[model samples]
Each structure stands twice: as C-alpha cells, then as structure tokens.
Target: MNFSAPTGNGGTALLRRLVWLRFVAVGLLMPGLTIWTSPVRANPHGGSVVHGDIHIGAGTGGHLQIHQGSANAIINWDSFSIAAGELTQFLQPGTSSAVLNRVTGGDPSAIHGALQANGNVFVINPNGILVGPGGTIDVHGLVLSTLDVSDGEFLAGGDQVFKGASDQGVTNLGRINAIGGDVFLIGKTVTNSGAITATGRVGLAAGEEVLLTAAENASGERIFVRATGSGVSGTGITNDG
Candidate 1:
C-alpha cells in the first residue's frame, strides 16, 4: 500500500519549511554557548622595578611583598590583579615613602583581595581599575587613576600631573582607608560605591587631566581638575555609598 501526504496548503507549508531550512543551512551557524568568568589571579604578576630601589618577593600563603628601599619608587607590571584570599603588601622605608605601580598590559587592574602599604601607593591603568566587593585597601595615602603620569613628573616629586584620553574610568566597590593621609581617585568617570575613610582628604575628580599637589595646610584640597574647554557632561563623580 502507498500512502500520500496532504497537498495544496500542506504542500505550500512544506515548501516554505524547505526554503527556511535551506536558508538557515547556508547562513552563519549559531554561535555556541559561552560562559566567561573573571580570571583568578592570586597575586600581582610580572612585576619589574622600573625606577628606584625595590625588591619583589613572595611571602607565606602566596602573598606578594614588595620592599622599597628608596623614598620613592616606580614599578611596572604586566598585570596587577589580586584574587580573593590573597594579599599584596608594600613595605616602604617609612610612612613618607611612595610607590607608583603602573599596569602595562591590556587588562585592567582588579583588586579583589587585600592591598596594604605603609606609605603612599599610586596605581595607574588606562584600561580601567576595579576594586571588587571583597577588596580592601589600607595605606597611609592612596591614588588610583585611569590617567597617565610621566615617570619624570613622578620622580620629580613636587606636583604630579595626570593626563590621558582614556574613556575607561576608575571604580571602587570595596573598602579603602588612608591613615593620616589623603585618597584621590582620578579618571574620566570616578565612582565609589564602597566605604572610604581618610584622615586627611578624599577627592574624586573626573576629567581629562588633573593636577595633584600637596595641600598647603593639613586640611585642604589636594586634587585640581583641569578645564577641557568643552567641559564635562553628566555626573562625573558618583558616590553611592
């Protein structure tokens, strides 16, 4: 026995289905499902002393310890990311010492752990910077920026000028405390949704360029944003917490 399928409308529907199937077969295949997670970096990797007397070593429990012998030091890293349950510390000469850490890689610096220093710590990455929910920063002074400052300006030590065209900004979603010092966050867009405590001052500036200078008095402004002629739009500085 021979069986025949429905014709007329059924034939039209069958033709349409065949055409659709052919079109899909010739078209680009649907992409496979992809899942992405943040890279787990236990410590700051690929660090090299760029300018100053500094030593990098590992401590117990995968902690990164940087010993800076000079009053001011500059260290460049391929990437500076600390995973949860990790700590990165800087032991400088004293509370007056400072260390500049620049990330040279394409990825931004992710602080998902603990970052502590005895003196001042300056971190610059044009890509962007994120202090995650569990991250913590404790230092005498702290400067986190998406702008760029020349080595000459940093080594000179008086007033450091940071200027860059990077649209990537700096965000803090963790805890930051500066003991008897100031905390400055500079970028195209600066945001703080975490806790920030400073004995001196806390400045968040969003602009193309900014000048950081020592406060004339103990209680004064230390960050000055430059005018870009066109002016900035929207809320440049956001503090939700």
Candidate 2:
C-alpha cells in the first residue's frame, strides 16, 4: 500500500504533523469486559513503508505508514483485537489500498474504536471481509469497505485494476454507524444483516440543552418525554432506542 497525495494538498501534509502518538491500555483480557482504558499506551509507528504483510495487536493502536512516503498500510494479521474506551485508531491509505484480515475464526474478531481508515480500505483473505455478531465499525468519519465499485477518489478495489481478484466479498453482520461523516461500503459483494445508521447523530447534539423526565401514568403505558426543535425550521425528531 502506498499513498502519495497530489500537490497543493496541504491538509494531508498537516495530517503528517499529528506527531507519532502512542496508545497505551490497562485492562483485562476477557472477551466481554470493557476494562481497557486506552488513554495511555504504546502504539508503534514501525516505519513509513509497506513491505508485504502488516500486523496490529489487540493491546494498543499505532500510527503506521507504508511505502516510505506513503502513509498507506497493508496489514496481514493472524488475529486483531481491541477492547473499549476512547481507544481511537487512524489507518490512512489516502489513495492507496489497505488490507485487513481475520485468519483463525469463522466468526470475525471484534475491534473497538472509532476504527477509521482514511483511504480505500481492502479486506482480503480466503475468509474475505466478514464482520461477526459482536464486531462493530464505528464510523465517525470516512469509512471505505470492499463492498462497491471503486471511483478512484476514496475507494480503490472492485475494478480489478489495482487489486488482484474480485472473488472476495464483504459481509457485515455487525453494526456500522456514522457519527459526523459519510459512510461508504465498497465491495464486489455485500451482505449486511446488522444496522447501518447514517443519521449523523446519536443521543443529542453538542452544546444542546435538555431538561426533561420520563414518568409513568396510571395506565402504565410507559410514558416518556419527546422533544425536538430549538427554533429551527427543519428540526426533525427520531426516536430509536
């Protein structure tokens, strides 16, 4: 995987200035325990080159690059895992192709974050791109999956031009949600049994004020408060719990 931004793209140069941030974690190793707090840990920026295979552990998240100048990454892992907390990871391939795989499980392993990929992300292997029941992809920004045809902008597969074969597909049996950015799932084949919420919002907006309560009535109909609008014209209300 290689990333070479076009000239005059100062924003990408600024992205390089984020410094090599190390992610540290402290928690249990159980499957369901949300015990890891990744506020502090060591995540390695091994190099700025994509040699062949890339591997990321379940302990900490790192800022990695490929092809020297290209910040793109090609990871070949036996297993990838992450717990919970504000453990964020940024896997940027820009215009390059990136690979993520799960080797041992018919059920896809779980990863936690705002797990992000800044460029066209590729999920390849005999297993293909499969997200299991507990797996989730929290897309706070751009999310590129191997589920659609590539347009050369944010996705780069499915055309069989850069990537080798198109026999592999993507299956998301988990959750993929958008917090503040667009969500794009690109692959030759896509099967989504989970939820894909691109509403761009969760509970409330930033700096919003809420003063309400939930009370029960004599009929026991589970009465709850519902409010939407702050003097805005198209203030919509969506109730999904």
Candidate 3:
C-alpha cells in the first residue's frame, strides 16, 4: 500500500510547514545559506562525533546514516533534507543491519533501512518505514509512521521466503502504542492496498474534529475520538477469509 501527499497549492504549504517544524523539533539551525557538504561522522566509542549530530558510515551491502542529537536534545531530521557529496552505500558483503535508536534524543527522527528505536520515536514521511531483504526494524516505543515493504519481490522473491529464508523475517514491530499523527504509505502513485491493524480507535478528523470512520479498508483511515468526543459505531473494514 502507498500514501501520497495530496497534490496542489494546498499541499505545498503543509509540506513546507512540516519541513520547518521538523527542523525546529530537532533544534537544527541551518545557516540561512545551504551547505552542499557531507555531515561529519561520529565514532560513539571514540568521541569523534558530537552530540546532536548525524553520522554516516560505509557498508558492504548497504549504508547506514545515524542521527543522534545531544543526549539532552531530541534527534529529529526530515527525510527530505537532501544534501550533495553524501556517501551512497551499496549491498554489504554479509547481511548487515542498521539500528537507529533514540539513545537519548528527540521525538521523531527519519531512519532509512533496518532500524530500531528504544525511546519515544516518530517517523514523519508519507512512507516512513522501509523494509528490505534481511531488513528488520524494531521499535520499543511509539512508532508514529508508515511501514513499507520495499522491493518485496526482490527482497523476498515471489514467495514469503527469500533464498530459503522467511520474507516475514524483515519485520517492523511497534512495541509501544503509537501516538499523534497517522501512518503514511509511499509509492510513485499512492494506492490503498496494505492492511493496518491498530489496537486503538481508527477514524477521521477535520482540524481536531472527527467526521467519519469509513470502512476498514478505507484509505486515510483515521482515529479521531479525541477530536469528536464520540467514538465510531461500526464494524471497520476487515478480512473475512
């Protein structure tokens, strides 16, 4: 399944605000001027990295980009925050895993590939979570983001297993209940195809006002009891088979 930002002038403003709020949410003050440079790498064990900074490393099978702001500060970064001269990693020799834990930072941080967060975490992207072959991301706290299976065919072949391995091996688990925001999907063109299982209420909202709770398979499924002050009274979409 995929989720996309509604196109038009209205979406443009929302995207801009989201981008700006993201920067402030993490306390990143970029120079008024854009810097076309790579971020400094940090060696947590070597103290080569600074607190509240992002780190990039090379890998054989893939690449790992870690952003762990200060221990006291939050770690927030937008997936759209693009840069040049950035190191692009390819497949590593062995099945490698990348983990992005809050360790001690902010509310939401953009993590690519296999990742793990221990503290309160938020993923702010139309399709925030990306799962690859041998790629498994685990979260101990709230995972306010969308989960995606990238290149599923190639990652797990046509079957649920890849190279005799279970495709479900690359799973994204949200240990804590998700808070604010909605899960988003990504694709060239968004389509409603994935299944979302929420333990909490699911419905819609209009500026803190919940208006409807379409069918279960309904795209843009929202949980807005907080806004409406009333709960939905219907059997949400479900699979009978």
Candidate 4:
C-alpha cells in the first residue's frame, strides 16, 4: 500500500503523523540541554553549607538557621566584616574550638572587629593584645589593641589570651572576673575606670624585666599602679560602689 500526499486521500493523516514526529524529537533534545546549561542549585537536605560559594541579595541579606546542630564556621581573610542582622550559634567547642583561628599568612592577615557571642566577646587589634571570654556582653576591638577574657559564670569555659606592647592601660568598665593569669601593665600610663580586682595572681613586666614604680606623686597626677599578687603595696583602698 503506497501512501502519497499528492493523492490527497491520506494527505491529512500524513501531515498529522509528521507533526507528531517533530514534537517528539524536540522533546528529547530539550531536556539534556536544559540540565547542562542551568546553574547548580543548593541541596539543603543535610544541614551542610559549603565554603567558596557566595549568596547575594537586593540590599536585604541572607539568613542561615541550624536547629539543634553544631556549627563550624571559618573566616580567613585580611578582615571579615559583619553588619546588621547576623546571628550564629556554636553548640560545641566552648573554649576548645578555635573559632577565631589564625590566618595562614601570619601577622600580615591580622583580624580586626568586634566579635560578640551569646555570652562572651573577643576583640583584637594589630599592636594590642587581649585574652578572655566575654561575659554576657560585646567584645570591642581597635586598630592598635586587643582584649580577651576567660572564666565567667555567663560565658562558656575557655582560655582567652591577650598580648600587646602598647603603653596604655586597659579600662574595663564592665564585669570581668579574671580567675587565672596575671595583670600585665607594661604600658607607661596606668588608669582603670573599670575595677582591676584580680582573683588569681598579677604580674607586671616590661621588656624582659620586672618593672616597679616607686612612690608616685598623687598631687602631680601620679601614675597609679595596682598589683594584686604575692604582696600588697599601697594601703587599704576603698572600692567605689
């Protein structure tokens, strides 16, 4: 049975079949091309957010929420900046985990900013040093100094270490109960608006030598020195309420 479109009897039927064949061929070719050209979408099933991937928005921001799970966040840059509406939780690694790990490029990649955890805070700078866990407050940092806190009721258990060769005394207006370590005042000026009461021992050193200031003049703006270690130097001082 030879079917010809010129006879016009089976012409309409042939046209319908031809149209159906073309449609099927297009359907087969489209799916493979589409899959190959599209961008990779996120797989949010396993509670894993990989690095090297960036998410952008229209001036609003992005939110990442993990419920009842641990978080391992790392930022190794010259300086990491955080703006409004950013919250992170670490279920594990209170003092053990190095959340603020050092950058690979040594001192060249020093970090600077205010890091405020749920209970504690840690602030650091280029020429200054701080070592302590923040207790229920924010840790503020400057360009030339650093601060650290440890052993508090509110903040988690950890060893905060601070170091610097600056010549300015640190003013602690907030509550910091230094359980261990020494209060080092290598700086020339000594003034504390915040209380400098130590729980363990305090050590004052200056360039590989133990520094001791003798009989500073009170009337001529004497540089006050308070050491709470083995011996008490000054007479009984009143604690301002």
In order, candidate lDDTs are 0.74, 0.31, 0.23, 0.23
lDDT of 1 by residue, 57-161 (tens): 965697989999999999998888888889999999998998999989888788889999999999999888888889999999999998999998888878877
TM-score of each: 0.81, 0.35, 0.28, 0.26
Winner on lDDT (1 vs 3): 1
lDDT at residue 59 of model 1 (Cα atoms): 54
Clashes of each: 0, 15, 15, 20
- Model 4 CA lDDT for position 145: 20
Q: Quick one: best TM-score, which candidate?
A: 1
The alpha-carbon deviation from the true structure for residue 118 of candidate 1, after best TM-score superposition, in angstroms, is 0.5
- Residue-wise C-alpha lDDT for candidate 4, range 122-161, written one tens digit per residue: 2222322221122111222111122222213112322222
Q: How well is each residue in 1-241 modelled by candidate 3, as lDDT tens digits?
A: 1122212223321111111111212111212211123332211111132223435443323334444433212232323221122222212111121122221221112222234333233332332222222223333322232212122321221221101111111112221122322232211111111222323332111111111122233443322212112321210111110
lDDT of 2 by residue, 57-124 (tens): 34333432222123334444443343333233444434343433313333222343224444433333
Query: In candidate 1, which residue ranges exceed 4 Å CA deviation?
Result: 1-37, 217-219, 233-235
Give, for candidate 3, the lowest lDDT window spanning 10 residues.
Answer: 161-170
